[model samples]
Target: MQFIEFKKEHFIHDEKTGNYSLEIPKDEIGFGDVRLQKKQDDGSLAKIDAEIIDDLKQIKIILESPQDIRVNF
Candidate 1:
């Protein structure tokens, strides 16, 4: 299976409060403060945790160029 691993900042670091510090912009509902997101097979964006990314080093393929992926505000 292929997956898009986002950078660490997008995940919620504070487990106790479960609060994601990044501020969300008013124009975008779930993406205002997000630094990165994973693109699902169905073309949906899912919120990802930084820890998951850290553990993904064992089994990830690095792409030389962008294919069908795009990030926009």
Candidate 2:
């Protein structure tokens, strides 16, 4: 079996909230908020919490199981 994974990152600026919104991809399966920050002198991302919104579409896959297979002799 083989599967493909796709991801897209978008930055949303809201004047009312005064924060940046992270929009996840529509075809991916994971959605959540992640912290992002500028790199410090030690080259580590700062601890900044950012909201991640998800607008994903439905995904469907069909596979043939062993019980569904039939053989004719």
Candidate 3:
């Protein structure tokens, strides 16, 4: 239950679209407790959906939501 800043090396941002791609540790998604949240203008967090692809060692989160803002996991 850690809040990761979007500026870290764990993510990729798409400037053309309001979306992001992130890579995380395999253990982080254990039991499917992973949840995606986007930062709102009011400095609050908003829930967003993502496409998580579990590769062998890491999990790839392909965010489908069009939100070009800070996010936490």
lDDT of 3 at 16: 86
Residues 20-47, candidate 2, lDDT per residue (tens digit)?
Answer: 4433343443333322333344654443
Off by over 4 Å in 2: 1-10, 29-41, 53-73
Tens-digit lDDT string for candidate 1 (1-73):
2223434344334556554333223333222222335566797775444321112112121222222322233
Q: lDDT scores for all predictions?
A: 0.34, 0.30, 0.61
Predicted candidate 3 versus true structure: per-residue lDDT over 1-73, tens digit per residue = 6454453344577788766687777665453445567677787877656776776777677774445334334
TM-score attained by model 3: 0.54
Task: Please give the range of 10 consecutive residues that has the lowest summed lDDT in model 3.
Answer: 64-73
Q: What is the Å distance of residue 30 in model 2 from its true position? A: 3.5
Highest lDDT model number: 3
TM-score rank order: 3, 2, 1
Cα RMSD of all models vs. native, in order, equals 13.9, 18.1, 4.6
Give residue 25's lDDT in candidate 2 (0 to 100): 41
